[model samples]
Target chain A: MKIFLHRRGFIARIAALMVLPFVAQRRAFAQSEAVDSLIEKITGGAPLQRGRVKLEIPTLADNGNSVSLRVVVDSPMTPSNHVKSIHLIAPKNPRPGVASFFYGAGAGRPQISTRIRLSGSQGVIAVAVSACWDAS
Target chain B: MAARISVPQNARRGDSIEIRVAIQHPMETGYRTDDNGTSIPKNVINKLACRYNGVEVFRAEMGSGISANPYLSFFIIAANSGELRFDWVDDAGVTGSERTSIIVAG
Candidate 1:
């Protein structure tokens, strides 16, 4: 009876060990999906081109409560071809949307710097929308 | 609520000048418990707008994710000699503003 009980307990432990990774993976997948939907809502399903917007944040922040962030978008900042807005998002924060900056005709270079709070370690995403889409 | 705005006193017309603002606020995230174990309600600046001589030039919408004592910096083209006015409001309906003049040469 003792050997049988020990065998059952070992099997149970093995099962739990096998399920742990999948559980973690499912959680990670859900989080990325949520971020994707949020981005889609902002861009209206527009294709996100990856080369123009630059997001700078600390790779290993000592403090998660407040971290400095900077975003620079490549734009001429002309009257007709300027960045209309920039959105900062933190996927793992209590509130995902960090901030949104809007620029008018008087805006010059498309760049901003600010401080943000992070609940935990996560990737920060910066989205810059231009007033007019550039083919080049 | 005290706020500070930094802008160069003089800039040539068509020059891209940087503007910075730092304000004092708790930016309570609604996730913190006080000494008595009462949850602190969220109160952060919701909207901030900047106008150049009565023309809106920049605006921002911030959330609780912003750290306390929010600081922001951006660039704006110096068109003419005028006042750069900043107006912001918080979640508790408190409004604050600060203005500074800049002289544009040439």
Candidate 2:
């Protein structure tokens, strides 16, 4: 912030620098919480806890057209303990639910990589569900 | 359809290796029309999946936002010698696949 202020001491620069964080903060919060609700809706309102899901994406992407992504879930992949499905959510995109990948014990490891389109810069969320946990 | 792939020929057990795949296609968007003034029906690869030794390891779903001649890069943990297969389906209901093999050293 100091560097930004020092580089551009103009009034517009000052205003922009100040407004940027607020805007980013609001958007970030809305986008993330929206993604959380989307996951909950997909899972039928099950308890949504965050852990064991890894989503890899570029921090800054100029072109929202085609962005590469990778997601991995830490699971044992055994019948008694395994990941049944992994879903991706991009809250701000035209389609919130970008992709859904199904897996079973045969999948060995629950991981996937693919390309996605983002209308603008926003964070992505991935949720992996456990069959054992769901079965009770 | 022509597809090209690049994967590690051999890797030490538990090594995370890179895999790249590129497919050739027009990927026409419905928004564009031909010289005849008829809208060029959209035909894009909507789904792509990667399977290792008959087990699905990766999957992706693309939309019209994707560029033509789609190329994707992914990773996998090499546990043993097996075949890595890729299958894709376009909106036009066309399906294609490509296969490659990798050997892991224990």
Candidate 3:
């Protein structure tokens, strides 16, 4: 009886130790998925490139409440290949989709500078769609 | 609800426009604990859209990764005189919008 009890206690401890990290990892994975969903939704299933949009943010933000941000897209401000719009999105904020901007071909430049609040250190995304001059 | 956005009343054509917007809300993410250790319910803005003279130019969907009092900046080509509109929506079904007009130079 004594031996059985000892073995049972040992097994229980080992099982718990094995399960803890998995639980923690699962939580982290869930958070990642939540953010991914936000991005997918914003793109409306469109493909996004890593270097296409330039997102300028501080490496470490002093205040999570307000941080400065600038997003610039590589596009000519011409009627043929201008940027139609720009969007800034954060998946973990109280509001996931932060802001959107619409521009026309007549708008000469394609750059924006603004400040944003971040709940924490989270990924920021900028989406730009090229103007369809033929349609216009 | 209405969103508060501020931009220069006058901007020259072909000049880069600066836009400042301040959204009023708690921006609760539901993951944090209060002083009492209770979980806070998630409340976040999920969608944002902007328009120039009624044409859809830019759109974004957001999550809880943003902080309170969210601010955004972007540019628009100043070709013709028209209104710039900003709109955003949260996860809990709250929506807000603000608008400003720009006088373009000939």
Candidate 4:
């Protein structure tokens, strides 16, 4: 009985050791689907590339009340190729949503500069989606 | 709600112009305590948008992290001469909008 119990304990320890890092990695990825789904609401669940979206914010912020933020997306402003919208998400804030920007063909470029509030230190996410539309 | 807006009154057609919008609000985060030690309710502009020539140009979904009296700057091509409209809404459902005219030099 003692040997069987000891083996069971050993097996459980090995199992925990194997799974801990993956759990740790998930925690480290800043995975906040809660805010991502908000973007999904606007995109209608279309596929999106995690590229072409740029966000500029201070690496270190002194105040949780307000922080300067800038976001940009690469796109041609032609009626056939244009950015549909841009959004900012702050996962740790009391309100995770920071901002959203919708761009038309007339928006020569997809970029914006603004100040936002942050309740604490967290990863900020920027996402942009584009679609073609007729000028008429 | 009154807002201050800036845009190039005159721009060559096809030229890109910058639009600036500044709105007035307290953007209360509801985290701070008043003189009576009661927690203030969170109130901030949750959404913002800019429309050019009656078409949507840019829109933003904001949170309490947004500063009081938010200021936003963005770009738009001078496609046709028309007015640019900026509008926003707070948590309390109060809405505000402002308009500025732009002359596209043909």
Candidate 5:
């Protein structure tokens, strides 16, 4: 009886150990999809290059009700070279699309500041499209 | 609802000037319930647009993820002296508009 009990315990532990990574990986993938797919949809599956957008938010927000947000993109703001639009995404929010800003050549600088709400602790992503990229 | 807009009184031509706007709103998320346990309907500003001298300069699409009393600050070039008009509409189909003028020096 004792041997049978010990063997059952060992089997259960082994099973748990084997399944842990898979479960964790699935959870991570789901979270990534929530954010990545939303971004992809906004960009229309366009390839994204890094280093143009700069998003500023409190590292540790005191309240999720209203958090200040600022986004800056590198652009000269001329008729030919300017930022087309900026999209703000909060993955953990019930709706990921926080806000989207469209700009014209008259926009002197590619920067904006606003307030947003968050459902929980998560990273905020800002994507900026340049006017020189495409017609649409 | 009332909206407040601020623009520089004067700016040199070709100079960049800051513009700030704030609106009075609840921006209800519809996720909360009252004492009766009845959920509140979501109502937030869905779109805002700014026009400079009848030319569209900036626009924003907002969702429930924005906080109550939405406020935004941005920059625009003082190409000409004219009016800056802001128009916005909320989920409840209510529209609000405000205007401010800036003087650009030559």
Candidate 6:
């Protein structure tokens, strides 16, 4: 009886060990999917490039609640060349669409600075669309 | 209550005008746990719009990513004396606005 009980205990421990990792992995995958869906909704199938928009964020955020951020687009603030909109996205935040800024020729600068909350360390993306440049 | 906007009392025409605004908010994310281990409801500013001289120049859609007491800075072309208005809304459907006038000079 003792041997039988020991065997059952070992088996149960092993089963738990196996199940825990799978559960954790599943949660992680779900989070990733959520973030992807948010990005898709914000961009509306627009291609996202790496270097067009400058996203200035701290390499390591001390607080997951509020982080300072600045987004600057490399566009002239002219009537024909100014940036139409700027989208700031945080993939892992509870609300992924952090902010969207719209600017016109009347806006003297194509830059925005504000404080943002981050759930954790994650990739921050900034998408800027201009009147002349095609969506990418 | 309405949000508060602070800008220079006088701005010169042809010079860049700096505008700053701060709103009182908690900007809570639903993921946070309270002292009793209960999840807090999400509350954040979802949108902010700024208009100068009756024309819309800048607008932003905010989210939980924005911190409490949100502060935003931007600039506008100083052309003529007019009013600068700021409007913001949160996820809970709460709205606030503030406005100030500037003296533009050539």
The lowest-lDDT stretch of 10 consecutive residues in candidate 6 chain B is: B1-10
Which 10-residue window in model 2 chain A sums to the lowest lDDT? A12-21
Given the true complex, what DockQ would model 2 score?
A: 0.25
Model 3 stretches astray by more than 4 angstroms: A1-53, A64-66, A84-108, A114-136, B1-3
Q: Which ten residues in a row have the lowest lDDT in candidate 1 chain B?
A: B27-36
- For model 3 the local lDDT of residue B44 reads 74
Residue-wise C-alpha lDDT for candidate 4, range B1-106, written one tens digit per residue: 7788899999999888888888889987777777888877878888888888899877777766578898899998888988988888999999998888888888
lDDT of the candidates, in the order given: 0.77, 0.65, 0.59, 0.69, 0.75, 0.67
| Model 6 lDDT tens row, A29-76 | 223676657545654544444444666776765555567777777766
Per residue, candidate 3 scores C-alpha lDDT tens digits across B1-106 of 5457877777777666666666777666567677888877778776677777987655554445455656555555565678988888887898888888888775
By summed lDDT, the worst window of 10 consecutive residues in model 1 chain A runs over: A10-19
Writing each residue's lDDT as its tens digit, candidate 2 over B1-106 gives 7999898899888766777888998766566667778777778888988898988877767665455687766566787798988999999899999899888898
Question: Candidate 4: where is the Cα deviation over 4 Å?
Answer: A1-30, A39-43, A132-136
Candidate 3 per-residue lDDT over residues A52-90, each given as its tens digit: 567777767666555677776776566666676666666
**Candidate 1 local lDDT, A1-95, one digit each (tens):** 11111111111000000011112222222336777786666665555555577777767666666678788888887765778888887876768
Model 5: what TM-score?
A: 0.84
- Evaluation by TM-score, superior candidate among 4 and 5: 5
TM-score of chain A of 5: 0.70
**Residue pairs of candidate 6 with colliding backbone atoms:** A47-A136, A117-B65, B13-B105
| Candidate 2, residue A116: lDDT | 61
| Full candidate order by lDDT, most accurate first | 1, 5, 4, 6, 2, 3
**lDDT of each residue in A65-102, candidate 4, tens digit only:** 55787877666666776777777777656667767666
Backbone Cα, N, C clashes tallied per candidate? 0, 0, 22, 10, 0, 3
> Which digits, one per residue and each the tens of the lDDT, describe model 2 over residues A1-136?
1111122111110000001111123222233566656665656645454556777777765455556767777766667777767776666665567666665334546666766656555557676766664332
lDDT of 5 by residue, B25-106 (tens): 9988877767888887889999999999999889999998888999999988899998999999999999999988888999
Maximum-TM-score candidate: 1
Candidate 1, which segments miss by more than 4 Å at Cα? A1-31, A133-136
| TM-scores of the candidates in the order shown | 0.85, 0.64, 0.60, 0.77, 0.84, 0.76
